[model samples]
Target: MLLGLHDHWQELCHCHVSLSIYLGFLGAQGKFAYKLLNDLFANYSNALRPVEDTDRALNVTLRITLSQIIDMDERNQILTAYLWIRQVWVDAYLGWKKDAYDGIDSIRIPSSYVWRPDIVLYNNADEQFTGSMETNVVIRHDGQVMWDSPAITKSSCKVDVSYFPFDGQECRLTFGSWTYNGNQIDILNGLDTGDLTDFVENVEWEVLGMPAKRNVIIYGCCSEPYPDITYTLLLKRRASFYIFNLLLPCVMISFLAPLGFYLPADSGEKVSLGVTVLLALTVFQLLVAESMPPSENVPLIGKYYIATMTMITASTALTIFIMNVHHCGPGAKPVPKWAKKFILQYMARLFFVYEVGETCKSSKRQPKVRVVDGRTEEGGHQPRVCATGLCLCRHGSLLRDVEYVANCFRDQKAAQKRTGEWKKVAKVMDRIFMWIFFVMVFFMSVLILGKAI
Candidate 1:
């Protein structure tokens, strides 16, 4: 009855020789008798042959062939095998191509612009995905998706995709193929849709070498966005970032924190601004460190951090020096001679004049004021007022208006006196440390910037 029913349908036959495979597997399962039974039942179509079930979607037949898979001790695989798939359609062939430009734009479409579905899937019996630090993309025959590592390599689909990669793009491919025992089935459900518009990306294809193994790994990167979904595969990679862009800015900003040395502690803005910049750099450093891999050797930017912190620490120390000088000091250290004599003269009058001349004559000239009625203008403001400015304004203020001109002159003297006292307080530092630290920081920063350049 089984023979009569099966003979009435179309029969397909393929020989499968599983000598060392299934027998060994059955032996491990304590089912060694199945090997014996298989041998005995080899000639019987009635014993272990197909029993048709009308409920299944695809009809399947099972046959035990009395053959041996070649000993294959010196087996050589075919290096180049064109993929053969039952194609539903074939588009226009790329026989020839021409390159042209519309206006200043380049349009690139060569004879190689032709694409084909040449992806192949081969099974490696030993490769397996373990569910640990690794991940395997899982795609069901029905298209449901999930990811988990399988203990055994029952099935894998190998593809050398040239349709969806670019020079530096990145993408990740997940697997859903899994096997439980030795008899696991790897079904090739096949491509359901073929849409070339689904993937218009850069190509990441390169030939790789494997001596003792067969693999389909070619270099690939992220794919560009497509207009539709057409069974895309991608491999994900962690984005790479430069240490300078990632960290140096914060370190540099932090390094700027110590510049409060120029600020008078008596002014309300000194420590407040310094401490704020310090906190900002610290926070930025912490944030930058989060993106870095853990390493014992500090990054180049980390060295910058240390150096910058050293400079900032020096700046902070100078601020402390200024505070001490303003409050109390020994031997009455004179004010910075440069700040008093040369710096005030050259910087305020000469350097400042040069800067003003450059500002006035430069190509980037903008709106600027020619004079100030005590209300200052932008870009003309300096960090600190020099005694030269006091002297400049001395006779000018002395020539005041008729509205209590004597009182205005007295107030002007008081302001000048305050400026002189501030200078005197600043003079307590032996100008030696300021000049030394300035040159040191300048030289070091320039060296670092040069190296970076």
Candidate 2:
């Protein structure tokens, strides 16, 4: 009984201490700071209710951004700040803050979070003579989210009597938050899907600093897996993904087709090999395009692949054309005369002109001849016989009689039998086709090599 009485006595002392502090400062006129501490800090003397135990520690990890409001000297500013009180916390407490109305007008922001002053221009001159801030943060999904700690406290809610000292306008800040089940706010609270969207509620804010500090609170949490909270931030990190599956692989395979050009066309294997590679490329392209989103902008590499394949296809076609032109005579085939003319002039120039010059050297011979005087009354010159069929004979010579003439004619007929102009024309055409085909081939080879490089 004595032990129990001693406990009661301690409780009475705590109550008296709390009541006296409140009453003594009831008419307190200047902006004052008051802190709401968890009963756990009161030595548990009157900790009539124990905090509920929970499995998850981090329920809703909130990244709070706070700023200081300077310029209010009003003392009756009934201000309050709050945080979603964590259950069974080791040390949880609430605090009221100060507003910087002193007009020091200088800010020294260090690497640490400390009290400072504001005013001036930089990012929009709105903070006029100051800097705005942006930061990235990670937090756990704890269903128990904090109220705009810049408000008055009522269990699950927060209300700030007055905030934003610089502005005379009055407004209310309301938060949208999750409702709780047994140990945490179940996702079933908001959306019908039972996904975390159920807890998508706004956590509002009111800013002030010093004297009547833009009253604020730093939500308490320093753990992981936050068992009780339903919306798992860990799960969300893996959820955000893209569906360009077909696009990715197609890009890579199409680029591989250009490797076909490394083969030389002269190698008898070139034609069949090129055709096979083209077919394989076509199949792979079909595979890559299957999963792509039907859209306007194809992947960057897709266009490149298309260009390269088209060139290779064209390369294959030209190879076939060159081989046919080389094997078949242009006159015998359906080749146009102008095409033959152009090719012969430009592409076949060296062969046609050079071979013709060689033929002229072998067939035509300029021989030495003597002009002789004949026994006619007037002086006359007679042409002499030469090796190249250019010569003259006396009109009345006894040896040039009918029998002699027949014998000479027979010899000349045998010589004429050895030559034919039609044969020469065919040989010239062959040489012309050969040279033009080679030049075109060289040009096309350069074009293809350029594409590969």
Candidate 3:
């Protein structure tokens, strides 16, 4: 029993010794971290740059990763985005030997305790210029400090909306130290291009690329060069939204303007149809204007709407004229000889139009002979002989009465013929104008909208 008790006592002693050693090791690490923090900040000043030599410029490397595109306001010319900003620099006073600190190689500390570069976006448009969230800074034993901050930035961007829904835009985000010149602090790009590995896709825009460039320029006020890093975000509009909502409807409505010519003049709706289409195009133009900025450069879609409205307006006026020509009465003047030859003859033949009961075989048919009051009439002219082969001079009173009635009939027929010729001229003009306007719309659509593709 005593031997067994001795064995149990040995096991307890071994466990107690192991626990004490592990506790001691943990306490030592805690002590080392506390000591390092005190030593680093004891003589350090956050206001001064963390450099060994004041004459030598401190290099701060900057890197940005796009997280999401929040919004792009074309009217206001602003670009809002979420980004991950990383800055790396060396602090000469923050380094320590790992052997003296329980093999501590890195530590996390509040950023306020260390010096950070005053880098800011130069073209910020928001009231609050800086939109970064403060986080802890990582310090390595070799004096390297890394600060990763998440920022939601709103920067000014100049937008060119001439092509509108089919347009691509390039916006730049310029970053540099606000107070430090190139001689005091030099900024460097970690990579040739901005990082986009974690970028969230936007519904209305597609990111073509983001390229970064370093620029050093000297202002007139200061001889020292001010350095800046510019990241250009190249974006293209998706265009599908505008295509369905605005462009397709306008195109369909534009074609309707030409169809107004096909409507009959006597229908009384020809002019009304043209006017309604014109008003619809105007409404569409207003919709486009509401979305775009009030700029001098007109959008491609807006140009099309204006052209369509003009054509519709002209069609309405011509429709009114054609209706007037169709309603010519017996008192109206006869259609000019030129109109009969050009419009009624050449243009009528071109448009495959002819008077009622007139056809290709009508010219070959035999003339009709009519007997009126015993007087035979051949063709359209009255004959001088009676149908019974008797001398018409024996009945002088009856002959005089018949001759007066025949003169009245010829006058009425001549008036009716003049009115028919005028109606035919109006129809031929309508067909010619319809085809002309149709061709105009076709070429206009091809030239203006084709550039988008």
What is each predicted model's overall lDDT from 0 to 1?
0.35, 0.32, 0.86
TM-score of each: 0.30, 0.27, 0.86
lDDT of 1 by residue, 279-350 (tens): 665665576456444545354455555666666666666666667656543234344655566543433343
Predicted model with the maximum TM-score = 3
1-453 in candidate 3: lDDT tens per residue? 999999999899668754553454356487787777778778889999988899999999999999999999988889999999999999998899999888999988667778999999999999867668877789999999999999999999988888888899999999999999999999999999999999999999999999999999999999999999999999999998988899888888888887887887778888888888888888889999887878898988888888878888888888789878988988789888888788877788887776667774453255686876656577789666545757655488988887778778878988887887778778888888888888988888787668678
Instruction: Evaluate model 1: give its TM-score.
Output: 0.30
Which parts of model 2 are misplaced by more than 4 Å?
1-267, 279-296, 329-337, 348-453
**Deviation of model 3 at 274, angstroms:** 1.2
For model 3, the run of ten residues with the poorest summed lDDT:
17-26
Q: Name the runs in model 1 displaced over 4 angstroms.
A: 1-248, 251-255, 329-453
As for TM-score, the candidate ahead, 1 or 3, is: 3
Worst 10 residues of 1 by lDDT: 59-68
What's every prediction's RMSD, in angstroms?
23.2, 22.5, 10.5
Per-residue lDDT of candidate 2, residues 260-341 (tens digit): 3333334566467557656765765565445333445453334434654675576566556554443443234344566546
Q: After superposing candidate 3, which stretches have Cα over 4 Å from the reference?
A: 1-31, 356-401
